[model samples]
Target: MKNIKLTIEYDGRRYLGWQRLGSSDKTIQGKIESVLFQMTGEKIEIIGSGRTDAGTHARGQVANFKTESELSPLEMLNFLNRYLPNDIVIKDVTEMSERFHARYNASGKQYSYYVWNDVIPTAFYRHHSFYVPQELNLEKMEKAAEKLLGTHDFIGFSALKKTKKSTVRKIEEIRIEKNGAMLHFTFIGNGFLHKMIRILTGTLLEIGMGKLDINIIDEVLANKIRQDAGETVPAAGLFLDEVFYE
Candidate 1:
């Protein structure tokens, strides 16, 4: 058997999420598994680097699966693309070392949230970006974002449920860039918790709108309470930008 790694990109508007939840739910993993099962007539499990919430999209999501098929990388890519739905595309496929697990081996991940700031929402960006009518103070947003860098317990930004692991994570970078009516916030972190990015985005939006004091970021981080944070933004604006591995 060989371990095959796939680099996938998808528009998550039509899918439940990345993972398969139920027999009836249409998901990225479910669609890929269905295609693999049809092509090989074998039950195969694909492991994703991470999960994206419903309506979230991805540009460089990585996944891996084990198979005994002797097909070459290009051939497998073509075969999977032919069977997979149009929303999900297998951008590349390659054979990897047997011990390379997609999730565990990932070094870090990058996510970006897009916002359309204009008087009227654009029909073309309806599904891709969050439309906000109020003008955002980018300077204030950047100031608040800087505080989020480095290692910290992100309990306030995460789901209010206990997990087996620690909520402490290191954010390597946070960048805010705007062009025209498009505003993008990119975050690179060692790892993330459920809805962490969206919550962070919402909090920053509050700062931008002058609803929340930029200095309140310190209190939110110190409080470590879910309610202390801002609202969780819609998943439509979030995208799994990239996954990195060594």
Candidate 2:
């Protein structure tokens, strides 16, 4: 058997996230795995770098699976693309060392949240970005984002209902950049809890809009309460930008 790595890009607007669900639901992983199973005649399980929530997109999501097939990486990529739906594309594939696990070996991940900040939202970007009619102070948003840098317990910024084993994760960088009417909030972290990025973005947006004080971040972190932070932004605006591994 050989372990194969795949780089994938998908439009998550039509699916129920990456992982396989019941037979009725469509998923990115399920779509790819179904094609692989049919092509190789083997039942293979794929491990993704991370789970992207429903309606969240990905540009460089990675996954790997073990299979006993003689197809070259290029051949497998072509075969999968031919059979997979148009919304999901297998960008590249290569055989990797057996010890390489996509999730376990990942060193860090980068996520970006996009917002269309204007009085009138553009139709072209409606599906890809969150529309916020209020004016945003980018300088204030940048100042607020700086507090999220470094290692800290992000309990306040995660979904309140998760039973995760831990909430401690190191954020290497947080940057807010603006292009025209679009604001991009990018975060790089060792790992993330469920809905963590969206919540953080929502908090920053509140600060930018003068709804929440920037200093409130300290209290929220200290309190470790979900309600202390801002609301979770919609999943449609979040994207898994990249996954780094060594």
Candidate 3:
């Protein structure tokens, strides 16, 4: 058996997210598995590095599957690109050692969120980015973003009611940049809790709007209270930028 790793990009406007739900063919994973099954005539199960929420997109999502088929990685890539939906693209594929696991071996991930800070919303790229009419104070947002760097318990920023896993995660970096009316935020971390990035972005935006104090980042981390965080931003604005294994 050969273990194949795939790098994928998708516009998540029409799917139910990355996981394969029972009896549902409208998922990204389900669509890819169906294509693989058609090609190999064998049921193929793939493991993704992580899951993106519904309506969330991906630019470099990684997944791996073990297959008995003799098709080369390039051949498989060609077939997948030809058969998969237009929104989903298999960017690259490579054969790997049997020990390489997509989910278990992932070392870190990078995610990006985009916000259009203009008052006038353009028809183009409406589905890919979030529209916020109010002007944002980029300086205040940058200050707040600095407080979120390093290791902390992100439970306050997450949406999960409970998790057996540890809530403490190390945020390696957080970057905020603006080009004209577009504000972009990028986060690099060992791992992220459910809805963590969305909440962080909302809180930062609130800080930029002068609605929330910049020091509240420290308070929330110290208190570890979910209620202290800001609103959960829309998933449409979020994208899994990359997954790192090494």
Candidate 4:
């Protein structure tokens, strides 16, 4: 058996979330798995490092699958690229030991969110970023983001109703930058609860627009209530930047 690791990039605009739903072929995993099955003539199952919500794009999403095929890594890469949709690309492929599991062995991940901070609409970034017309108070947003840059219980930030697993996560960094009319928010974390980054960005945007107080970050963290946070931003602005194993 050969464990093949694949680094994939995709524009998730037209698909459902990453996971293969019941009989749903419009998912990232389902699409790729179909191609792999056709290529190897085996029922292939691919395990992704994580799931990105619907319409969320990815620059470097990682996944792995075990197969008994004799194809080399380069051949598999080329074959997948030739058969996969144009929006999806196989960036890299490598053979790994059977001990490697994409989701279980992942150590960390980095996500990026883009905001178009401008009064007029942007042609290039129409589908790439969240458009906010009101001028944002960047300084206030930065101050609010600083309060989120450490280990904490993020139950208040997630959209899930309940989970047996712990909600504590370590956020290594939260970088907010501006270029021209674009506002960029980068989050590097050991792990994230579902919709955590989107909720964080929404809360920060509210702070930027004076809808929420800057000190509300502390209140939300202490309260551990989802209602204390702001809107869940659209998935179109979110990108899976990288998945780390080491």
Task: Residues 172-209, candidate 4: write the lDDT tens digits.
Answer: 99999999999999999999999999999999999999
Every model: Cα RMSD to truth: 0.9, 1.1, 0.8, 0.7
Model 1's C-alpha root-mean-square deviation from the true structure amounts to: 0.9
Candidate 2 residues 68-153, lDDT tens each? 99999999989999988888998989999999999999999999999999998889988889999998888988988888888888
What would the per-residue lDDT of candidate 1 be over residues 144-238, giving only the tens digit for each residue? 99999999989889875877788999999999999899999999999998999999999999899989898778987898878877889889999
Q: What's model 2's overall lDDT? A: 0.91
After superposing candidate 3, which stretches have Cα over 4 Å from the reference?
A: none
lDDT of each: 0.92, 0.91, 0.93, 0.94
- Which order, best to worst by lDDT? 4, 3, 1, 2
Off by over 4 Å in 4: none
Using alpha carbons, what is the TM-score of model 4?
Answer: 0.99
Find the 10 residues in a row with the least total lDDT in model 2: 159-168
Clash pairs, model 2 backbone = none
Q: Which prediction has more favorable TM-score, 2 or 3?
A: 3
The per-residue C-alpha lDDT of model 3 at residue 238 equals 96
